[model samples]
Structure formats: structure tokens, C-alpha cells
Target: MKSKLFDYVERDNLVFHLSGVTKLICFICLTFSVMFSYDIRVILSVMILSLIFFKVSGLEWKQIKLMVIYVIVFLLINFVLTFIFSPQYGVEIYGTKHEIYRFNSRYTITLEQLLYQITKLTKYASVVPLGLIFLLTTNPSELAASMNRIGLNYKAAYALSLTLRYFPDLIRNYQDISLAQQSRGLDLSKKEKLGVRIKNIMNICVPLIFSTLDRIELISNAMDLRGFGKHKKRTWYASKRLKRQDYIAILIAVFVLVGSICISVFINRSRFYNPFI
Candidate 1:
């Protein structure tokens, strides 16, 4: 039997029972908190607490390891480019510079620069687990319903749901196509040189694109046949009413946001926490 698309969300968990709207709001609040704050304490708090929630949600690190690695790599590249273009950005932000290494006149690394990059990395890291949780734990239909309930246009919300649901199907199609190509003796294995494997992977893209387009056409046709957009309003079978826990979760998220603002306004007197002082 083929497994269902949202079977992953059926498991029991601390966060699974919350309304989709609650989770969405919480994720937004938490993300904003991380985005606007530069306090090491606040960043570390959000990151550590998010990891705890990830575990409480019954999500495993192994499941998201590849995505985590990719994000880290991107952050590293961004940090490198930041130093390349504006190596003294951190000194300007923090108003202090403790030289670490003298590569050249314009290329000397400073503690301020290193710390600023670390802060940027930490902010990105803090939000990733929350993003993963929202993605992996929320049912597509329920997310659409939540969005619609929160005043988004039903058309757009439903479109978002369809996009999310299509991803796994796309992955399956890719895997099937890869297997077919492999059987025909196109090796995409580690035994081949890296460049050759990359070229072999690019060959998979053509078939994958055509297949995806075909699937989309079929889906659009089916929706049209069913008169999907004939009505202005629709109800979702997967939607649920908010419970006490859902309200509590929103409150907690609100607290994080409010606390973040407070820290910036009163404690830091700036968006950044000055470790130098």
C-alpha cells in the first residue's frame, strides 16, 4: 500500500494537537524574535528552546540533517562574502575592533567581525527548527484552512496547500525516474567522478520537468472538472477549532515577541547586544 502524504503528522506529539493557525502564528512570532534581536543570550535561548520543542514534537535530527547542512553551507558562504565585500562591517556596528589576524591592510580579521558573523549564523540557526516543525508537522489541508480562517483568500490558501502536497509527489517521481535511468546503465554513483555524476543528474531534469508538467495539467483538469472555484467559500474537512492549549501556545509566542522587543528597547538600547561593553 502507498503511504499517505501527511502520515507523518498522525503521530502523537506535544505540538501536533495545536490548531494550524496557532502554529503558524507561533512560528511567525518566533522567527521575528530571532530576526530583530542580536543579544547572544536571546539568540541562544531561542535556539535551545526551539531544539527542545523539536524533540517534543517527535521530530528527529536525522530526518532534517541534509536540509540543515545545506542551510549551514549557505550561511557560511554568505559570511565569507560579507567579509570579502565589507570586512569592517562588524567594527562599524559594534564601535570596537580587536584585531585577530592581519592578512593584509584591508583584509585583517577582527573579533568584532567574527562575532558579528556568529550572531548572523545564530539567528539563522534559531529559526530553522521552527521552520522544519511548521513544515513537517502541519497537515497541508489544515494549513490551508488555517490560512483561510485567518483572512487569506481561499484561492491563495488552497494554492499554497496544493504546492506543499505536490512536493512529495515530485520527490517520488524523481526517485522513480532515477531508478529507471540507472537501470538503463546511466551511473549516478560515487564510483564515477563528481563532475560526471553532476552531468548525469542534469540529464534527469528533462524527464522530471515534463512529468511534473503532465501531473500539474492532470490536477488542474481534475480541479476544473470538479468546479473547484465555483464557490466563494469552502470548508475544510481537516480543519479544527482552537483549544485551550492552542491559545496557550499563541500566548507563549506573543511573549517571545514582546520579550524580544523589550530586550532591544530597554536592555540593549539598540537592536544589537554589545558584548564589547
Candidate 2:
């Protein structure tokens, strides 16, 4: 099958071989570690590790290029807004200011602020790969199975699984509808002005939404006929027993989480690492 955005690929690698439960556990631990700490060292290390794992998983750059571009644009906007709103936030946290450039008293750029923003950017960047890995390496049915194994309600788990699986279908439907509209002389191409293109795109939404609602109703009726969610428990075809590698992966994730907390709480004595001090 052709891989759609965030679609799982079957492979012989260790990451692919691991149970979905293990991937979920590790993803949670690593993301929490990044979110809870402001240390650049910790964040960069996680980001680098995530990149290595992403490469090892055999995913091509083209698969995530659009997503990465969007994230970078968002982070750039966030960095600009952070400095605009709270130019002295880093100085307030670090208790020192080494001014780099003075736009004015209120808008001066400082080393501390730059470092803080870089750290924040890295913190967010670290999670992107981990999220993509989880989404792209784990099968939707297996993810639902893992969630249910972790004590989530089976109905919720199944719903979540269906939601994940729906994305490719959504993309396909959008393409089909867009082609139909384009064939009807609704130009979404570069020949149209930017505003015109956007307005034309909005026209596709009405049919897309109606089609999506029709799909939902069809699935709901099918589920009702099949007596889905009538039982308190259900078995998963994709479920697997955790293996030795799964245990090791979970252990490494736990160690990373513990190490992040220990460094922030014990060594740094704060989440923010102050080089100025």
C-alpha cells in the first residue's frame, strides 16, 4: 500500500518490531521529560536522539518535510512573539542581562533572552520526531490494542484507532473532490491570485464535510449492526505480548525521564539552567 502522511510502514527494524505499548510508553516519557525541563543540554540531547531514531526507522525526509516546514514557521513566529512580549523574561529568570543590541530600553535583545528562546525552540523541536515516530511506526489497530492493554476503555480505544486511520481517507477524499472541482473549472492553481485560490479551496470544504458526515453515518450504522461496543471487553487481532526489546526500550525511557527530573531538581536546582550565574 502507498504510504500516506503519517502512515505506518512495516519494516524489520527494532523500532518497528517493538510492541505499540512500548512505543506509547517511551513517547510519553520522553515528551514529558522535554516539556518539564528548560535545560538546553537535556532538550538538545533528546532532539538528537530522536533524530537518530527517526533515521533508523527508515523514514524518508520527504514524508515529513511539509510538517517540519510548518513547525519551523510556527516556532519562528513564537520566537518573535516571545521577544516582543517579554524581552526581559530571561533576565527575570536568570537575574542578569548582557545586552546584545538595543532597539530601545524596552525592546533590547540580550544573550540570556536569545539562549532562552533557543532552548524553548529545541524543547518543542524534540517532540516532533518522537510524535512522528509513534504515529508512523505503530499500526492504528495495534495502538488501540496497546491503549486498551493499558486500561483505557475499549470503546474509546477503538474510536481513537478509527480516528487515526481516517486521516489517509480524508486526504484521498480531498484529492478526489478537489480534482472534481478543478475539472469543473474551479481553478486552485497558480493561475489564480492567492485570495482567489483560497476562496476556491473553501468551496471544496462543503462537499468534503458532507462526504465525511456520510462516512461517519455509514460506519455508525455498520457498528450498530455488528453490535460493536456492546461488550465490556474485546480482543485485538494486532495485539502482541511484549518482548525483551520492549522491556529494554521502556527501561531506557524511564532512565531518561528520571535523569531529566534529577538534573532539573537536584543539579540545576531549577528547571531553567542559568549560565549567567
Candidate 3:
């Protein structure tokens, strides 16, 4: 199951033509651009462009359904909370008040606040696609390789890689253990009521934690035996030689960064706030 999950992300055919660093740089640039401005139009544009890039990367919709759901939930929660707490937030941005409902003393619903919340939602939506792109396209080993290329110690890089590599394994192990327990007369299904489900999950967590600890101890022992931290420069199996594509990718990344900075200045004359607001 673990191998299958790793294989899903580390598709040999898909990864062959792309550099991990290129993906990383693009992700960072797009994320920064999303963060730098609060203009809804710019945010929407970035979001659409990110979706196009994801499609071009050959990511399957089925694999990303959970991510899409998460983004929806995130946006919904943010909008709900913002509206409840700050119904007049638009007055701050647009200097207008179109009231919908007046509460006792300090609370009121207004058009400006709703639009402000919508604008903030757009900002979040803009960056979420880029975050998903990074997660879906970057294999653990490739991510570690990218980190190593950027001057991080190989041991630290490998540790981060292993953490990501083992996440799906840990999730699978939990699912398998839950199923085994269910087969042995434990009811963990949602039909068991929320309280019962919580209790059963807690019951499952004890053994899961124990197993995880045991695995960690075993890995530590093996690494110690192999003198993992004895030398300064450890070798990496996933390292790729920088090629013409990599150079081109880096050049493009630099161009994007510089261009973004210039555009940011032209649009706002500063890095912090959107002048259009």
C-alpha cells in the first residue's frame, strides 16, 4: 500500500521531463504573488492560471478530489467566520456602508463587509491551487533532492523526505488496523454514533502510536548502525545532475521573480498593499 501511494506521486513517465526545483520555484513565485496583493481580479487570474498549469502537468482529477473538497471547506469556513465577525469590513476597504441587518450594539450586516469577505476568499482561493500543485507534483525524494541542491544538509533533507515518504504508509497502517479491529468485533463505522466512534478511534490510537514508536526506534537503530550522521557529506540516491532544462527552468524562475517585483511596484508602488484598494 505504501509503495502504491509513492508510485502514484513518483510516476516515472511524468517526472522524467520536469525538474523538482522548477516546480518548487514556480510554486513559491505563484504563492508569493498571491500573497502580495488583495485585488480580487489578480487573485482570480492567478487561480485560473494555476488550474491550467495543473491540467498541463497531467494530474488526474480523481487524485485531487480530496484537495478540491478541502479548498471548498476552507473557503466556506473563512467566509462564514469573516461575515459573522466583521459584517462591516467593507467600510474599511471601500469607505461605504450598505447595511443589511443591525444588531444590538456592535454588530451589523453590510454589503461592503460581504464583498470584502468575498475578496478575501478570492485571495485564499488563488494560493490554494498553487499549494495543491506543489503537493501533488512533488515526490518526497525529489523534494529532498531539491532541498539538498539549495544547500541544506543531506541528512536533514533525507529526514524530511522520509517523513513525507512514510505519511501514506502511516495512514494505510491506521486504516488496516481499524479494519482488523472491526473484523474482531469493534464497530468503528460512523453509524456507531459520534461519541462511540470517537471512543473507538481513541482505542485504535493507542496501538497505532505504539506501532509508530516501534517503527521509529527500529529506524533509529538501523541508522545508528549504518553511521548515518558520522560523516559530513552523505550521498543522495535521488539527486539529478543539473541539465539544460534545469538551467532554463532557473532562468525562467528568476525572470518571474523579477517581473513580479516590478509589476508589484507598478501596481502598488510597494510590496505590502494593493494600491487599487
TM-score of 2: 0.97
Each candidate's root-mean-square deviation in Å? 2.4, 1.5, 3.3
lDDT values of the candidates?
Answer: 0.87, 0.91, 0.71
Per-residue alpha-carbon lDDT of model 1 for 25-54, expressed as tens digits?
999999999998988788899899888888
List TM-scores for all candidates, in order.
0.93, 0.97, 0.83
TM-score: which is higher, 1 or 2? 2
RMSD of 1: 2.4
- Across 1-277, the per-residue lDDT of candidate 3 in tens digits comes to 2223332454444334567677777777777766775555556777887777666667666666666788899889988887677766667766666788887556777777766677688878777767666766777787788888888897888898888767777878888888888889999767789999999998889899999999999999999998988988766676666678767766754665565566667865654343224
User: Native-vs-model 2 lDDT?
Assistant: 0.91
Model 1: runs farther than 4 Å from truth? 1-7, 193-195
What TM-score does candidate 1 get on C-alpha atoms? Answer: 0.93
RMSD of candidate 2 to true structure, Å: 1.5
Which one wins by TM-score: 1 or 3? 1
Which candidate number would show the highest lDDT if scored against the true structure? 2
Clashing pairs in 2: none
Better of 2 and 3 by lDDT: 2
* Candidate 3 runs further than 4 Å off: 1-8, 12-16, 98-111, 247-260, 269-277
